[model samples]
Target: MNVPMLTTDFLDRGVELYDDVTGVIADDGTEYTYAEFGERVDRLSNALLDMGLEQGDKVALVSGNTHYFLETQFAVQQLGMVFVPINYRLIADEYEYILNDCDAKVVVADHAYADEIQPIRESVPADTFVGYGADRIEGDWHEYEDVLQSGAPESPERPDIAEDDDATINYTSGTTGDPKGVVRTHRTEHVHALILAHHMELVDDDTYLWTLPMFHCNGWGHTYAVTGLGATHVCQRAFDAADTFATIREHDVSYLCGAPTVINRLIEEYERNEPETTGDRPVRITTAGSPPPKAQIEQVEDQFGWKLIQIYGLTETAPLITTSNSNRRIAQTDRAADLKVRQGSATLSTQIRVVDEDGEDVPQDDETMGEVVVKGNQVMDRYLNKPEITHDAFNERVEGWFHTGDVATVDEDGMIQIKDRRKDIIITGGENVSSIEVEDTLYDHPDVQKAAVVGTPDDDLGEKVTAIVVEKDDADLTAAEIEQFARERMANYKIPRRIEFEDDLPETATGKVQKYEIREEYWEGESRRI
Candidate 1:
């Protein structure tokens, strides 16, 4: 008999087998057993049901690495509702677009971020609003605790959810347009979580730290994998270098994931403060969002005595298709750091190929750059409401394969290393910023006539968003003023870090700005363009 896969299976197993175990530790030091966690999820499910949310309805959550974020995910999925986790860093307008785009019936936001949504609540489709800390929020919102108390602390009646039913809608930044909702089904998320758990080497006795944002692809699917494995989740509201170290010691955290920037920050903190690195247990960290430099990897493994794993993928691909955590590969080489820095070969059952413009596989000599394409169950079902774009994404370069739009080179051993991005998206500090979006904001400035945005290599952040602009005739504009203007319009991460005045931008015969040529000047001696 074939069994239908569902995301709720993770939490169900935790509740059944690990009822007495400490399942989650809230950011505020509140610990909940697996049974308590399951009941809370049930309460949330029943609460949403009482609020008129039916199966397939979308419930958007805007929060940091909090327990409620995890609870809401399992709670929503268990009842066959779809969960939409929004980036807490986004502005009200950006949230407005996502909340409307997903057609969320309910929105649950953390108090720290509820202000951003309160102003645009009327503009969104969500009829009900719940705040995690309602007392601190300046709006008429239902308190999360109150909402939970209003519903029964028992599992809500589940609908007949199929394996292909929509489970989550994660909004990813577009290359040249608005954010696209990457639709993931129950089967895709369930399989991805299982694959992630196996590759990350999660165990029942392990404690997972929440240094990474939970909203980021459901904490890169760790919310399920870690829970399903009966591991303890130590929540941290946000990633602070000092707090991360303290929490690891406090909770005996054995595993965590973060971007290269997080690794750099930890290194900086370690050098400055020399805090205790780990508890009795050895710690393992997985870095992605951008390749960690060799020095960072070495410092993490050698100095901190922690194993570092590098992974590669996008929001559209369940965010983990490849990982550089092969123990056998490292055993053969003295230069283990070198291998760890490269986004290694495909994970179990995931097929990855680097192809030239003609869709033919490129030579795996590690020097020839090609666009990376992939096919796997973890891949997203489609971009919500964007059929044409979704079709082109899978059909381009190679038919039936999702084009990653990432330029990479594969070594003889099939380890893929990313070199550049084919799309005009700047991934600065693990956040995607669209060059076109920033340019449009720059153009709104009366003094700005032409602007080109590019990603410049940074030692800390994998890439820094840089802007080159030509001011209007006789119009003087300072970089600070332009940055301030951008700050008011877009998210802080999307704001250009470095702005340069230019006489004119280089263009091709078709009058399209030659961004590749413009970016070459900034990445003069860098080994990689991204």
Candidate 2:
């Protein structure tokens, strides 16, 4: 079958179809109609072309969620240039590596992050580095507003991009180590947007709130789907529980995507004061980054009455390979609480399998442990400048499956139960301990807010299990008390041997607890990345 040819074609469609109604609502009370936003995109594209940007050249965008980011994304694609969205949460050096690695030709950044780019001015050898703000800086740079004013509104010829042509390069947050460039194509992104829209039940009536950062998987394909569905959009400059609740009520937001940390914070805020500002009905929230505990899931549904949908993916999978669809069985039974734990099956355009160490398919006995492998149209084309590693990722001890490096078990009911990341499992005294299990048990404690478990160095036990915890502000809890809490909930060996408490844990911008950062503190003075 021939693959469909699709570019940033939806932008043109949206501009022609719904040019009158409200399209984007920014945090600073800036609102634009669909026609006005489309014209801005065209002007931005013309400005980029006037500066002599070439086709297929990489343009890096380092900023948070904003309307400008969306315009720049479409603008670059209009000129047939590839867009590289850098995670703003990365350190200066990591940011430098990505800019250098991808050989970005131009960089457009917001003024708030000017200090972030100042540290490594000479690191990225881009042709132009423009900052978006009121003040002007000296060098080969121009103000964002000035560029739009200087150039005439000209439509550059869109390249005849094949389905395999590169469209964007999104870097993983480097939770494990060095970030890898997950290259996505227009076709992949288009398909991913469709899958997310269909699986999440997003429709024209849905009003989307941009909660997730656009730099991450292109806001997990919401930027495309929301526009394609002609859904109203509400933007937040940053995450604030009160602000989010108010936005939901103000704009009547029907759908949003966030990490479990976002949900946990919102849930905590609701529990603290029972938000009176919210609408009569609960909003829908889609959460990923990590498998949330059943207790948290229950809290979200019971207290807030919000529909919590669980999804699973990496940057390489367009960040949406599977989603927990409320099936007929789950809807009929009273086991909605139990169903929330499973990550559920693959979405419409994805396929997944659980296999043993020898690459054979594992039986869905709900007890047999195996690695989860996937193959789908949404899988990334390749990792930029890392052909060897990309080839290894695809040929991960299997014939044709792309190795996820995640271990899981699928029950006969087709629900996937994630055991652990292949590297996260700890074998202590020949007994395998899923770090997720320990963390799940810790999450049951009322005083514990966020918990992460990792294996620390040990001479006798080979590996020791440790739990790093963050406590609720008003709740006073000690390490011994937490140990007792875990002892009552889990098996003897699975209990954490050591407990560490902190005001806050290190996290990626997407709110994933950087477990490697947690483990690094315990393994200091060692030469290993772990």
Candidate 3:
């Protein structure tokens, strides 16, 4: 048995076995074998070194899900450098904050995002700024292709790294304001990769399609795990429902991981028209950004015949901690409908608990609610430069638990059902109400497609309940009708005092309804983070 020490080991081992096979299929139809991928990473590593980039230095990669993004990832790890993947959607100041904070010595940007990088050029003091893709823009940056050609096509010596050595710094999307840097170690990455591979049932035969942005927790660590298992990667620069369907048919993608929103969009397209595929079809899709509705889950199975496994985790948790894998109990049950509701049990390497403020364990009696806590190798090392936050995140007095701000309950069968984020809980007239519960109830309605409940301002009550709804096409949904539906299912206090109908709800990059964004209007001038 061989123990893995480097993240780059995935490509090295993959190429040795599947050197000639198409390992990466780009959108432009460009294919790269494992051997070619390894060579590109080696050249990228050598190029960084030649540009005077030292080990442990920060290198920022700003792009979507592209082959170069994947190459830069392994290259940074090979040279013992920290790969800082910046959110391409982030505004100039946000990008500037990341660059200035990380002090990145090199910035590898996507050519499509040239406008975003142009204004911020003066802010980055890196030795090199390489732009990927075909075409040249007048700038001080070097072409991505030119850099690879300038350096030797060989990987530098692997870094003498300990298990605790920092590998990457993932900037988490903040619901309130500025993004926080979550530092992850190589051990955390390696362990999480193995955990994801096992939990998601990833094997050598699996062909993964990248639908989620790679900037997001390294696409929930699928980048390494897929390669580790010698799985082919169908890389897409950007996500489109049509393109996604076409790729699934073209490559016969066996597995993919994305947010619930991605699944919803695909399901919408699928319902409009059935897609025909000639090759291997996708068998599984792991979703985690937000818990998908049961209707969406059923649609995935009914339409594409794919097993939609729901997972839950954040960028801080190395992205894969708990999953809703279908078990024998579900397979044998008449209630496949009920099983989809629970986010399910923890993975083999993950230990999950629902604890109270006192840090004692909450009862496994489904009715009891508590804050969800986890302790695992997948947990992040710390929040970079935020010791206070890091300290709060990893508390030792409560039996050394990493406090996940999520509130949840565990059923008798040991299934963990997340209720809501601790901050998202609503308190009206001294009563604690779960917005998710209200949202769930609203989702049960026939006309409702998407629902987000937020605590709005109220002179009488401390905070009034408000629900924003998106009605299905051609479905007649009025505020009075929705109010009546909520009134029957929920307590009068939990019912929305105000209802607003929208064509679409504001969403995060991952498709999670930015409840915070919706709540912001109601919470104008308020000092609270909620």
TM-scores for all candidates?
0.82, 0.96, 0.95
| Structure candidate 2, residue pairs in collision | none
Candidate 3: clashing pairs of residues: 252-280
Model 1 spans with C-alpha error above 4 angstroms: 173-177, 424-530
Model 3 per-residue lDDT tens digits across residues 90-160: 77778888888888888888887766777888877775678886366557778898898777976678767
> Which segments of model 3 are wrong by more than 4 Å?
1-4, 134-138, 277-279, 396-399, 526-530
lDDT of 1 by residue, 221-250 (tens): 899899998999999998899999999998
- Per-residue lDDT, model 2, residue 441, is 86
Model 2 Cα displacement at 42 (Å)? Answer: 0.5
Q: Alpha-carbon error at 353 in model 2, in Å?
A: 0.8
Model 2 residue 49 CA deviation (Å) reads 0.6
Ranking by lDDT: 1, 2, 3
The lDDT values for all models are 0.87, 0.83, 0.82
391, model 2: CA deviation in Å? 0.9
Q: How well does candidate 2 match the true structure in TM-score terms?
A: 0.96
Per-residue accuracy of model 2 over 1-530 as CA lDDT, tens digit each? 88554557667766777788788887786998888888888888888888888889999988777888888888887677899999887678887899999999888887777567767778787867778873744344578878866666656677667777788999998888999999999888888888888888887767788888889988988888888777767878778887888888888787888898988888788877787534644577898888888888888877777788888998988888887776685786686867777788888868899888888878989888889899999889999999999888888778667888888889887778788899888878778899988988898898889999999887777778898899987898999999999888888999899998888888898998888887777789866433
